[model samples]
Target: MSREIVAGVDGSPESLAAADWAAREARRRRLPLRLVHAWRWEPLEIPLEQDRPSQERTADDVLRKAESTIAERHPGLPLTAEVLQDTPVAALLSTEERAEMLVIGSRGYGAVAGFLLGSYGQQIIAGAHRPVVAVRSRDGAGGGDPEGGVVVVGQLGSADDGAPALGFAFETAAARGASVRAVRAWSLPPLYAYSPTSSALARADEAGGLVPYEEQALREALAPWRERFPEVRVTEHVEIGSAGQVLLGSSGDARLLVVGRRARRGVIGSRIGSVAHAALHLAPCPVVVVPHE
Candidate 1:
């Protein structure tokens, strides 16, 4: 059952865009696509019978239209439509265990202040065990970079700490016949930088004394992936800066931006990592947050 990619749809243009993106990825991965429309039955004033059926019809219509849209774009993509009588977040998270990943529409800066993020949407993204892709599209613009653009992926900590993100990026690039831009952001040790000791001065003479080590670590981190996806041309970027800012800068015109998150919640506590948060809000391309150990 985990061979399928589940996409949440609510008939909104953004959700439709997400369904399209998921369909494209499903086809690329040679997997099935499942579109789920979830809505809770909560009647404030109207009668339960009157409000319930209307919302149910709306849900059916949304799934039907999504299926049509995906079928038209991705012919013969092995698609299925489902309707769930539950909250969006709970419904999607429930399906994550049976799917490879969950794709959901997210409001970007283009949307009203970029502050329209639903608290529940963020919950599902942070709580899911598998990877979750938050998509914001303009007329389905990201069909893959026409000029074989890069797939920017953040390499966190050691090579294995962020293996899931790296592997997902490489596989996606290979599918699109595109290259990968692996970025590793590091800062000089504060204790070593400001100390007025002879050791600090000597190390500073060699161009920060940390760039080469960071470069080597990044290389080692990407080596196994490079071997696994030999056809995915890789360009290593070892920059000295904040992870979020560095990733945002390198995401220009990228087909997809891949980032890592720990399953046990990030520094923000019960939310996505700072880098992933920044990326989902600011990145111009589709962003996938891969959960790792």
Candidate 2:
């Protein structure tokens, strides 16, 4: 069996949280943890010789520090380190090729800064062949809080895309003695009341019929999984707004924001799902992307 949890470390607080989370996950799964830190040296335009030796030494120092930190915290973790000159995204994707799952800090030290996830995390998830877990900071009582917490999956009301991921989410949540939150993002388009189909839609909306129909669809979709994990706490929310925004907003205090991969087919190898993609970019906590499998 393949046994390793891979994560990128760059000495950031969020990445440190990711390291801790990955360590705990590996311990729970009885797998090894591979901690990788990638760095690049960009030569100045003035001349190739200027600051060359110093630059190389600095890169070496950074890599050594990263390796030592992991070794100290997780001794004998079967760890390995890589100092690559390739872009961060490329290095991470390459490292994840053989990993069972790639775990990354949701947010990183980016050019723009703030809570937004760095481009490296997004790109790695978009191209990873294995499962990717985007970890968030230990905000509030979410991290290392307990074994039984909650794993929330954002639902888009479209079973074709959202339904399949519930199985994986439930399995993960159940493994940790956790509950599942199946949420949906709903909205009435501006043309809802003025469209050519408006009359038919209105007729169906009598007694808030349309709302219930949508709710029932989500509930039924989640029923099978709920039945299997009867002990798991289950809750549903139908919020009005952008699917990505709603999911990202609701998961501020969640243990993990579980989502499905959504990307335009044909052009991309592994595309992050619409909601998952957006949430990974702004989630206040970790985000797990459950592929079609």
Candidate 3:
């Protein structure tokens, strides 16, 4: 795959907003930027006479407009523009095969209904081969923190479950000179179960009354990444709550939030997983859903 960034643009305010973010990210990574617009025929437009050619021209025009906007804002950035004849999701998925990361637009809804993540957006995120970022129209900068730059990632399941997401968060933080906030959520053991009787148990108490077992697990999870990115400041947040709620709560003013998804799709509907489901709908900042086996 090419080490470049790809963004979908169709002249919508949301698409342009995503393009702006993609351009800025391109500048950050010193990688080239590609803007793609996909067009398909519509049944009822201009008497059906100016059908195919008119649609093609419109697609080209949209591409040009988005290209010009990116150029004006990010001068001297290597840019490429293309118009695809496939549907939005198919075209973007095809383009993403050659890109390091794919950036797309979202309606930016938190508590609102189904409009923000329509079938198309969900399909694109689910079908992508690489990391996908859904950036909302407003506040294209994602977010910023005054005390320190933060990138939060949710750690769930087995030791390997969150490996991909934590690696992504650390890589991003290192690139931006930001710190990473690694959060792991837990719940109280079922009351029927007996607590460990001795300190020699599997998860012995470390110190500091903070859920010793969970705290140890969190530290073990972050150990390798911490060694890999020694310069990146790290924060380990262990809490008792839902994973989605914990991630959203810890991600305030963060530049990005990272979540993981299994590679398999469900029998029906989007298979981006639970944490990602909550994140795409409610995250105040951009969310990157990384797929891992």
Candidate 4:
């Protein structure tokens, strides 16, 4: 089967927004767009009147509406819509394995009313084997210049660890004819603010120059990507602060914010890292979490 960009639609405005975003993305990548809606029926607890048929019909309606929305936005886009008979998280997780990327609505806290990220969205982001993008509703709440068309990616530690995310950012920028801003967040060693000697040492280190080293590291990290995407305009931003904060701030002007999630094994629960968590919850634009080693 051919890989496609999948969007999870649940009949919410946010989900519709995600479907639209997914359609645009699929077109950008020249891939097919798949709309999935998962629904499960309640057993004896509910009346027979509101049982399997009702639930199935609701799921079908949602999928049909989403398909119509996509069709209206993308007339010639190759699209498929299906109603899956499983829990929302389960269906999305299963689809993620075969999808190029999974796009879902952010129903979490923020300016948007139904934008609160729910437990299921969090679960899928934490566990998905492929890249997952959380798109907020198409209100000014997400706070991005739709015309800006800039892709921002956060790089923590070595570029090797964030290569996948960076590559995604570059590819997105290249497709959109936009620019990529690669941000690397760093901090001073501990004890620099505790003692006078430590402060002096820090000043000496600064005099000998730590900023230059950080900048050099950022440049080195992006060197290969710059060569590979020669058509892409790249900007390296080395900042002193939390990675999440920097990325969130950058999202104001970004079309999409890309971050990396380290894949963990044998973990009991959600493995989403602190940065990815923060970005998903507070990013001003659509956030894409790319799973990496």
Candidate 5:
């Protein structure tokens, strides 16, 4: 029942890149790494003649290669691998139930190549109960700056609402000896756009009043976190714009981008907010979606 970091791999370069990132993260957290591959034979009508073995062999080979790669890069790191006989999304979601976090590649081959967020990745992110990180391939697309990079987290709610994300960001940054940049985005109320008096008041608020208040709120939200993680250097960023746009802009130089996902419960099904959605699809660095109550 001990918690460990789980990563999904399918023998693709992108998946391997994710594994690499996951391995480093595991090392940072001082936890074991588990690499999982979900596989199922195709053409069910063809009969199980050697096809099953071929599929099994492919999955084994992929797992072994990933294990070897992680060992080479991170010596003495605790590592394990598994081949699950189920669909990718189902397998990963099941893994999430017992994992501290689930890491996966941003894109894979075939129809998912060009898309920033592959269909399977999107599904897993939307459904995972735990934090999910999407890592880009190392060749040219995924991974963070080789040099140390900052940890950027998006904050849009009260301290209670954003506490989990802020804590995660601070922990991640502290582990990496990196700085934490907490960004808060705000705008005028809807009524301000229609009423002249409201508009003027909003303009006046923006001119000198709103920014300090926003910045103060962000500082207050992070105050306890800063105290808890005194080793971590923190920066408060307040901007006037869409939450998604502001987070995306800050992600370019970030080692990891953390965002909060409000937990939803109902028959209508759960949904990731627009800002988290944008981060998943457009972030240049790895994006971690942390579900908050």
Candidate 6:
């Protein structure tokens, strides 16, 4: 099958931005883009006086409108649209068997006032079968911009598991002619556990030792990348906090946040790692969750 990118739409500005991002990605890769609009008639029944034309209140109409908007705003892109009579999360999951990547807006029209993202966006990222790209409002697509092409690849403690992530990151960075900021985060156990003589009195020493070790870990992770892509500019960040937060905090200037999805059945399972799950919802920019298989 041809490469396919599926993006959710809800008539919100955030969703529109997602459509734009997905369209640019699809065009870049020469892949077909599938625009999805999932809607349902909740409460099943409406008061006779409140009921309007079924065409005006149906999911199909909403989807058609979205398709028209896309045609207007994103012309000359290979695209298709679908309106599903189901929840947004379920609708996206239904297309998992064939989609190369599933994209969704951070929030929708149904989102609560003053909230940046809705619950559906979070749920889909944590449980998607394929890679899930959570497109944030701040991620606007424009050509010839001098923005960073940095992509953060979240490692789940294994070099082999991180291969696809690094590959994707490197290619994206290369395409944009920007540097790759490879980051790794780890937390160390208390020094007292390793040394009976070590105590709070040696707190300064304990802190000093951790810096080198963190740097070494990050260096080892990027060793192969440096050898393989000597032409690509690579910067390493060794963080000492939650992986999700550090990655999210740095994503503001990133072109994309690449993460590995963990699975149990085959080479990859249906579940995404905890850190990848969190970053999808809270990332300052677009996040791409790469499946192991």
Off by over 4 Å in 4: 46-50, 108-115, 139-148, 191-208
Error of 4 at 236 (Å): 1.2
TM-score of 5: 0.86
Which rank order by lDDT, best down to worst? 1, 5, 3, 4, 2, 6
For candidate 4, which ten residues in a row score worst on lDDT? 139-148
lDDT of 4 by residue, 145-241 (tens): 2433689998877769878998888888887788999888877767546565675446546757667767776787788889999998888887888
Residue-level lDDT of model 5, residues 1-293, one tens digit each, is: 78899999988878888898888788888999999999876665654556668778988998898888878877999999998888999998888756989999876232223227778987788788899888878522333434356999998868898988898898889888899999999886565365556744555466676677678778889999999999988887899999998887766777788999987755776777798887777776778999888
**Relative to the true structure, how large is the alpha-carbon lDDT of every model?**
0.82, 0.69, 0.81, 0.81, 0.81, 0.69
What digit string (tens of lDDT, one per residue) describes model 6 on residues 1-293? 67788888887767877777777777666678888888665554645544435744675666677677767766888789987768888988888876878888775222112125567875686567677777755564343123456666665455676777777777666655668877777677755566646552255365577667566656766778778877779887778788877776666667678877765554543455677766665665677877675
Higher lDDT: candidate 5 or 6? Answer: 5
Lowest lDDT sum, 10 consecutive residues, model 5, at: 138-147
Q: Supply candidate 2's per-residue lDDT for 96.
A: 60
Clash pairs, model 6 backbone = 263-269, 264-269
In model 2, pairs of residues that clash are 136-286, 261-273, 262-272, 262-273
Candidate 1 local accuracy as lDDT? Answer: 0.82
- Residue 277's lDDT in candidate 2: 63
Cα lDDT of model 1 by residue, 170-273, tens digit = 98899878899999998777664566565634554554567877777788899899898888899999899999989888887687899998888546666688
* Per-residue lDDT of model 2, residues 186-214, tens digit only: 77756647565676466446537666756
RMSD of each: 3.6, 4.9, 3.7, 4.2, 4.2, 6.1
Clash number for candidate 3 = 0
